[model samples]
Target chain A: MTREQEAAVINAVLDGDVNAYEYLVKAYEKNVYNLALRMVGNSEDAYDMSQEAFIKAYNSLHSFRGDSKFSVWLYRIVSNVCLDYLRARNRKATVSLSVENDDGEDVELDIADEASSPQALLDRSLTRDAVRRGLQALPPDHREILLLREIQGLSYEEIADTLDLEVGTVKSRIFRARKKLCAFLIKDGNIPDYVSSSKLRGGDLS
Target chain B: MNMCEYYQELISRMLDDELNNQERKVLAEHLSVCEECAAVYSAFSMLSDTVANDLVEPPEELAEDIMAHIRRAEMRKRNQREQRAKRAASRQIRNIVAAAACVAVLVAAVGGVSVVRNLRRSNAVYESRKIESSSGTTAQGGLVDATVLAPTPVPTAAPAPSSAPVSQYTAPAAESNDNGGLGSIIRSWWGGDDGWFSSPAPTPVPTYSVPQITPPGYGSTVTPEPYAPQVAQSEAAPIVVIPDTPVVTETPVVTEAPVVAETPVVTETPVVTETPVVTETPVVTETPVVTETPVVTETPVVTEAPVVTETPVVTENPVVTETPVVTETPVVTETPVVTETPVVTETPVVTETPVEPQLSMAQPDTFSDAFIPENSFAPEGMAGTPGMDMSFSALPDFEEAPADFAAVSAVSYDFSEQDCTEFVNAIFGLEEETADDAQSVQTDAAAAEANSGAEQYLSYIDKLIATEQLVPVTLPEELLPDRTESLTFSHEGFKFSLDIRFYGEQMCVLGCDGQGQQLCFMSDMSAEEYDTFVKDCLLLNEVE
Candidate 1:
């Protein structure tokens, strides 16, 4: 949990106890995979990118600057790799960069209708896949804003810098993106009308 | 504004985990009632979950490859530097060995040549003298001596000419310039190579920087000015040629180098002397500057320190929390501790949630010296509670004390509203011993038509009250300490003094009454208490 403990584990993995890398893999695997999947919009590429992000992370371990926390640094690398892969693979496909430069503290919604209570984590396996499908179907601008704000976890300021825009512009686009997401979620019957704003912003931080 | 915009700023900030105290209170209170705002909060949070659901895992083989690249790079650079170092090291060793061998060869050649030259000179001198003696020739022998010595001096003069000018070559110049016998003897005395002429020499008459009053005649002897009179001989290196002047006359040139070498040593001796001098002078000077600096610093430190500290102490004690923001900057740094919270709480300024504890978690303001009352009722309570009717009760009641606690202060039988009430008229209506007993008690009916007046009876009571010091008259100023507190009273054709202690709500008064009756009374209850006896039981209201 501490930075020292994580660094020690990283060092152990680097020393060639190849399987020891799994502790790190298990710790950060899902978040990295989710970020990649969100950025690229396809599972196969997402899976490959996630795997590659880990391999690149392991190989460039010495270059780890430690200016950011280990999770943020790894997430940044993973996010960047996803963006680059998406950019390289699809030259013809238009991908408007949203607030993609934000820091890794983005908020993600599970569509409140999925849970009986807002605080409850979604337990259904296929539900996540459905949401992923829904996310991929949306435009890149909408998807990237959602990913940066929620998945990649970037702040508006950081996203503005990465995408080259003003913070107000980033905020507006995220607003439009969330509005579109809200429309889609409401159309899909994901959240009921009774659901309130407090439950949305007050998701169980504890 | 729409509910969204109404709570828009707070909703955004709260999502960021940034609510300061007052903002949190406002928001929390709002959240308690507004269902629509709560719904918006719920929806915003759901988007948070959907956005972060998929995490991309990295490939496992990355770390080893990067390390391999770095290690190879380091090794390559190290090998390149090491190879270059090895070549330079070998070249340097070879050059040192060759230089050492050349030095040895030169020493051998110089020694051998010098020995051969000395032998030839000795042999030539012997042969010339022998030939001159055999032929009895003197001028030719002198000519031979000059030729041999003149040519021989050339090699020695060319190489060591600078030092040679002192003795080796000085003899000839000194001899030729001898215009008088004294000059010739003086030249001889200073001429010929000796220890004084070894190495190069310091200038023969070394001039240095001094308070040069060119000894009046020396100014007329301006010929010495050609060499810049009194220019320190140290300015010229002793190993160089001295000017070819009569005063320095090349004979003493070699002495310059030895003198130059000793100059630094001689100057250093005086430095050692001045170190002792400096230590002595410093002690003499140190007391004034050292003591002066501290004394100057101390008075201000001692005087201003407390003043500065006192401001901080007062401000710290005052809790000028809000007022400080207004007057904060003007107040000198004495108690700037008041505003230190500004920097620390800036984070709360943004989110404003953590700021809630300040409102709910603050200490009782009663302890703060700066807290002023906001209510009329709270003459005692601080900040003023809302519901209490403090205005009517806020100020302490300063009503007159009772003449007698047991006796009713209301309407006495001064005039009859009716001759008698049904209860009073009926003899057996009241619960007493009987009407005859009451009549027996008022039996002083005709005793000399009540010998004295009612005023006389009242005067007796006044005397009794006055003796007790409860007559409400001011006590002698001498008997009371300055600022001592006492009750103020006026009563029943008689002034009343009651030193009542405030026990929370009830004012308890302990004093002697009109009959000099000592009693203690504690009451806040209304008049009905005396009748129902819920409270206000008097210990003494006696009559005979």
Candidate 2:
């Protein structure tokens, strides 16, 4: 739905029909859950955190005031929920944030699964594991920033709003996050030499 | 190292597409010189690319799970509100009984001393009781007041009614008190609506539970008229102020989150300093680059070739130079009077002045004497007798050669002011009964022919120039015409020549080919026919 439609739905929710809020939750649930899962590093905790964020957003719907996009506001709530959970538990750095299949087993999430036969899965599992380990190796703040920049593909302004930081801070932090992740991958020999060599000159950094 | 640090920030901004063009240019130039920065940027870029390709999708049931939680929370809130309302009702009933007992005791204690006075004033107490019952009618007014004053109490259950008459009488006051306290806390939290609860209730306080009704159409268009009667009832009493605390204290958790969260936020240092340094240099440089190119192109055109001055006619027709010299060279060399003329005197650049008569006088004494035939047979169009001294100075009158003749032209000559009317009419058997009639006929024919024929000739010239088949050959010094009107054109292996001149009163036409072969068509039926045939040689540049 467009922002105007979201605003109309929010107004209906505030006027006491609380069911109208399900539209907003349904619209942003995937992005919010993905953001939470990346931040908290586990399916169970990510699920709990996403629920809490949506509940909190619904209760506070009256205070929204329509100053920014609904997605930006919703992402802010998701980020805060994840941050609070992370801060409360003081979670260890070496936690893997991955998706789980219907059977509650941790599985790699591949959008194009036609080639995911056993042989292809076996070949890709190595690289996927290396990348996940490299992500887990960074500080939580750096990992979160990198996830927002690369995985979410958010603009600097949206990232700033979600993290409650200046746009410049978001830029510099994204840079620092990438550089640190690169160092981690390099130290583990996860990345090939061509990545750090002249062959990578045409790549996009931001 | 400091420069590297600054450029690192700039490079980061560049990757974000945050850098303006000038800053981007400066950073690019810096990167070219600094291999260390270049390597760092590349590594960052590679890392970003690798991470972007590895995306982690959320579980499919996440949205359903979130929605389930929200619906469960809404249900729990509603159940809690209903339970709270039940509890409030029971508590209100007990409080009402206790208040009635106290009122009875107070009346009994003062009963005897004021009995005689009370009996006299019993009518007044009954009247006041009637007013107290009016306050009881204000239940709906109280709820509207609470809703308008403090909206945070929206989902909570409404206050229950008291059973005793006195407690019911004070119920509206108690509701307003609840709103005042809750409104105060909300005011403190939002820093708005402070005066709403600050003033005491000037209107009569409604002392009963207000009815809760959703407006028609699922409460889509809620009008304020439902509370209109409540406002009227509240105006009956003015001194009731009940201090309620439960809802006011509970509101802080809902409204104060932002207040608690805003203070500890890390202050953002000035990060926008680099933008001004990006500057207008990019725009400034861009404008000058566009403007300088045209100036550069025009300088070469003016300084290089003045002979090719006029763009199309003079430059494309360089052949005019070699060909027109045929007439001008001889004119300058043969006549002492005309020798003073400029070399570029063709066309209108040299005045056609009264030099015509002087040039004509000079021409007959010299060149014309060779071309005139003595005792020439009378031409078919001539009215004069045959052999009558047909030389330039001694030609006979030919009756104005009536204007009914066709115009003719030959190769290598500018056919200026010459109408070979009588010659063309006599040769073509055009009977001229009257000058006006014949002239009109001839004029119409010439116009039609010139339109089609001139267009064909212009296109033929265009084809010759395009193919580069027409070479310009200079006339031999002795062969140049004395009059600049004569022109020569050459093609293949042949040069064709035409000279249109006046000898005394007679007009003469001369044609020559490259082999020194000459034909002079002065006046005869055959000569007129030959003149027509020779013009074809001008187009093909061939003599057969």
Per DockQ, the best of the predicted structures is: 2
Evaluated on CA atoms against the true complex, candidate 1 attains a DockQ of 0.15
What's the lDDT for candidate 2? 0.34
Off by over 4 Å in 1: A9-23, A89-130, A137-179, A196-206, B1-3, B49-544
Cα-based lDDT for every prediction: 0.29, 0.34
In order, what is each prediction's RMSD in angstroms? 55.3, 58.1
Q: What's the residue-level lDDT of B202 in candidate 2? A: 12
Error of 2 at B308 (Å): 99
What would the per-residue lDDT of candidate 2 be over residues B1-544, giving only the tens digit for each residue? Answer: 2687578778767766778999999989998998767877776566566666655556677667767777787789899999999899989998997896576556544543343332222111111111000011111121111111111111111111111221111111111111111111111000111110011121112122111112210001001111112222212221100001111111121111111111110000000000000011122113222111110111011100111122122222222211122112122122222111111111111111111111111111112112121111111000000000000011111111111110111012212122233323342344564234435433553464623222222233223234433222222211212221122222111121123333233333332111111223343334434445444332333211
Per-residue lDDT of B1-544 in model 1, one digit per residue for the tens? Answer: 3555446446545654445788777877777787756665565566666556445344454334334444565467669889888878877888886785576557635644543432232122111100000000012110000000000000101111111111110011101011100001101000011100000011111111000111111000001111222112211211111111111211121111111112221111111111111111222113322111111111111111111222222122122111112112122121122112111111111121111111110111100101111110010000100000000010011011111110111001111111111112121123344334323322442242422222222233333334442222221111111110012121111112222222223333323322322233333432332223211111111110
The 10-residue segment of model 2 chain A with minimum total lDDT is A107-116
Error of 2 at A148 (Å): 3.0
